[model samples]
Target: MQHRPTIRFHGAAGTVTGSCFAIETAGGLILVDCGMFQGSKTEKELNYRPFPFDPESVVAVVLTHAHIDHAGLLPKLARFGYRGPIYATGGTMDLCSVMLPDSAHIQEYEVEQLNRRNRRRSRVQVEPIYDATDAALVLTQFRPVRLRQWQEIAQDVRVRFWNAGHLLGSASIEMEIGQGRDLLRLLFSGDIGSGFKLLQHDPEAPAGFDYVVCESTYGGTDRLDTTDIGRRRILAQEVSTASRHRDGALIIPSFAVERTQELLADLIFLMETGDIPSCPIIIDSPLAIRATDIFEKHRDDLENGDLLVRAIRSKNVRFTQTVEQSKAVDFVRGFHIVIAASGMCEAGRIRHRLKNWLWREEGTVLLVGFQAAGTLGRILQDGAATVRIQGDEISVRANIRSIDVYSGHADGAELSSWLAGRLPVRYAVFLVHGEEEAMEAMARRAAALVGDEHVYRPRLDSAFRLDADGPVDISQAGPPPRIDPQQAGHRDWNNDYQTLLLDLQAELRNAADDKARGVVIRKIRRALEE
Candidate 1:
């Protein structure tokens, strides 16, 4: 008779995306956050791999939000024969209806583009992991639950959601799994949002958890209004300056959801306050336009959004819904601010805008998000004097400015403050959605402040078994996982060498077919060597 459930960290341990966790109890098995990998190429490659746990063996999936990193790979679970319900907040479900299909379309288009490039280079064909049909299949499995309602997700595992205020419908989940006699409580902060934002309520403290897995995206930095104040000051200063100097575009690479709308709200406020001379602020992303419309519909959830709008009382916040209207923003030219999506300037209309504006002295490129390690935004943010757009390398004369105050994630101090108010805990486990250095720093802070002797930074596929009377059992038993060696900087052998080694292994197995099964050992050894 097992008394406590075992928790496993499958994803989002070492990197920012691909958040998944499994809780195994005497009653059954439960999983959380079946998300696909994003960011760098090696990270994306994880999407093609098998789940660490048996997909069919998992009982249900509890989603915290609909961000691509949190809930994107859910359809793949269904494809792999898991018949289970996916529970999330109503807002999260609604957002997924739009985002999932969009994700499918983008994936299909990306695969097609990849094939085209591969064909031109004479390479092998590959397939998109899943399509719109798979996404559609996933939609049927979603079971919407309201915030603070604890449903029995599995036989003994009960889960509840609290608003994280990061995005529309985003939540921090509190899960209790056990017989009614006793239980182990686990809290997962799903991309914890900035406590204060328009159109969404503030993130609340997740109460009563034996173990807490918090996000640490801003764990290393202090919460500063620098992003908001600085961006506003620069936009006001530069746009006013640029308006006087020449007539060119101001391109802002933004995230489609919260970031775009936040920019609009701030800029609108700035305009009404007479901080900058009023020029047309064009929100050029179609998805952003639709999301803003959705934001309007879900006004009840927004934190003082209606009152804020009424307080400012400005009517020129533009939402460009059509491509024609978006293209029209580019032609207008002088003293204009254009916010576009796929924030890293990797793809979307922002790229086109950058191609045109980067070489010009009067144009300005404002970066307003955390640029991932390999993203084009990071390159520019790091002060690359010149950057490549499409196929041409263009001079980066446009002033590059980053204001992090608009960042939705909680910063280091905010994270500490959020935890500071919580009742003193016996132990805490930090996990979900952040980079490695950030996690390590947060772990240290949490350990020192909480005075918990068992603060842990879990490795991928590692399991934690809670003890009835004492410390946890930390052991090496876990699913056999293979992370890419190249990712950690050990790669002299490329694809060709890997193929040759595999072929030789196959040939050796066939010739010694009687006892060739033993060569499986050698094959794995050779593959690891490469």
Candidate 2:
């Protein structure tokens, strides 16, 4: 008799970020996509704790894609004593070269800021979770796998990669569980894309599987904005509207990966076809510029029939690096487009760009990506009149708009199509990488498609066995899960911290005198210490 596979949901079971799944079988512990948590403080703090399983116990890591939320924590895994070959596509490995270092740099800078604040009040200093050194060290162990080809990474375990159409080198993993009479197949849809991608190909139509684990990022609602052409028109219209105002900036909050490149290609095609005026376009993200170069390195993998190539050749576009150059844009007075990263308006130079243009009625602050709840992008998208930035409330008089057609994540309809096939499952489908509302909604739909008894939404740290009894949660299993909002310690700490920050900022701003301001600042410091 052969050993059967047992799976544990370590992350991304209850939240939209931090995707890590462990499979113990064939005398090997295999991991998939060790990502860091983002969003509110409670979620972010989870990244500081040790991985639920011992890092050294894992034999190999199969990365799904290079998105920070999908692959961000690899360096941390390396730092904590995981020394194994990580597998991904060539494009993903190339991206990790720039992305990992940048992630580490951000961690170092943020930790420095935290320590500076700590030193002010004599609180114990905290260290960064990981550093650039660890990130760089992790890059030395990359093993590339070709698409649609099954490669054995462990004893009796084989995996194949399929283009997910979400990003460059994005893959939906297909795994063969065992051999002979005990064989089973499973599929992991790694961020399936809605059709009409600018660079990558359409998502692979899924095949037969004994069990499936899929991401339900946009499962709560069926999306109306669905095509690439329709989305391009919206962008052109926004730019054209901005152009009519003579000297205004159309600030686009975009991610640095495929999203930034895709927008440029569309804008270039639009400008060439005279659908929009030829305005000066500025890409202010160094990471995006570098990623664009990498995309060019793998132009054969791009879709759109050479459209992206022409976009890269356009003369109206310019790439800016350095803080001084980005600041100088503030003094420019003309109809132009500025695309910046930190797409959710959480970090990066987009905030600076927003501060410059958000007050102008002529400009447009276009959101072309998913703005998670509680993020500044979501606030703007919801039509907030003013938003606080850097402790000062800034007026948002500019036009704010969004078009979801550019989303990399497949919506509910697309997911249904991808999941609907001739495949008959022996066990169930596990949903991950979505908000609770989204997962529950998708679970209902999935149950309707693949029997209600066969759809499982496992909690974080939940375990299931793929034994002779088929895939089922045995009463005897892994640790009981401690998941989001339900986890005891610091449950409301995120909300409380946010409210405290806002209150302190208001008090400091309204303070009548320097003595009053100092007192308020001291109170803020004390509250933080407490």
Best by TM-score: 2
Which candidate leads the pack in lDDT?
2
- Predicted candidate 2 versus true structure: per-residue lDDT over 1-530, tens digit per residue: 36778888777776777788999888599988998776656677778887888899898899999988889999999999999999999989999899888888878987897788789989999988899999999999779999989888888888999988899889999888778888888888888987777777788845778889989888886876567767777777777877788877789999988898889999988988999988888998888888988988889878863777777778988888787988887887778899998788877789889988898898888898877655678778877766776556777899998877788888887787788852576678999887778888899878878998888887667788877655778524555554553441122465445555666666777889999999877876898799
- Candidate 1 global CA lDDT score: 0.73
lDDT of 1 by residue, 159-216 (tens): 8888887888888888877765476777887777665554566688555567788778
How much is the lDDT of residue 178 in candidate 2? 78
How does model 2 score by TM-score? 0.90
Quick one: how many clashes does candidate 1 have?
A: 6
**TM of each candidate vs. truth:** 0.84, 0.90
